[model samples]
Target: MIKQDAASRTIEAIHESVRTYLKQGLTNEQIIEKLKEENLEPYYIETVIDNIYKEYEDKKNLKNAILTGSILVIVGLVINMLSYRLSENMNSSAFLLFWGIVVTGIVTIIRGMILYRS
Candidate 1:
């Protein structure tokens, strides 16, 4: 039986090889040659490709979320600032700021829920 560490190492090697092939858009035969040059087993390339694709998708989703949240936060800040100028009274300004914060929180929570549910 293969030791767990050794199996993990082999999988990592395969994963790296798959990433290389994807980056280079290489054929399976070419990928095998590349792996051979690196002294890695090429037979596991398909498994690696599958794993890498899933990893890429996960990373992409995370990146998109960060970008969306950042944009929304910036927009919320701008809205809060502008609301102060639009309101003449101090109480109105304070209320606008409070509502702006509440809106931002709600939007962020909704985004989190949507992402988590999916």
Candidate 2:
């Protein structure tokens, strides 16, 4: 029982390390390099590093999606404001708002899809 407990704890620690590496956007090869510098067992370090790289790729995609969506939303806001002030007719102002909404919605949907896929 004591041995089992110790094994479980060790596994948990390794998993946490992998999670940290993934969050930091480390590639599989990058993680392997880092792990090699540590004093961990060869097999254990390699396995964890491999898994972390796969997971990190997915997470990095999601992060990029979010950034793209945020940029679109900000740009849409600027366009909406500038268009509203420059327009002379109510129709043009409304059209600008519509375009802004469409852009914001498209970006948000893209971001959601990426996050869901990840």
User: Which candidate has the top score in lDDT?
Assistant: 2
Residue-by-residue lDDT tens digits, candidate 1, 1-118: 5699898897776777578778988876777677778776665565566667777886677667666666766777777777786675555535366455546655765675577456
Residue pairs that clash (backbone atoms under 3 angstroms), model 1: none
Pick by TM-score: which candidate is best? 1
Whole-model lDDT per candidate: 0.68, 0.71
lDDT of 2 by residue, 1-118 (tens): 9999999998887778777877888876676677667767667777776665666776777777677777777777777777787685555535457466547756775876766575
TM-score for candidate 1, please give it.
0.62
Task: Mark the regions of model 2 whose C-alpha exceeds 4 Å error after superposition.
Answer: 1-8, 16-47, 88-95, 98-118
Lowest-scoring 10 consecutive residues by lDDT in candidate 1?
A: 93-102
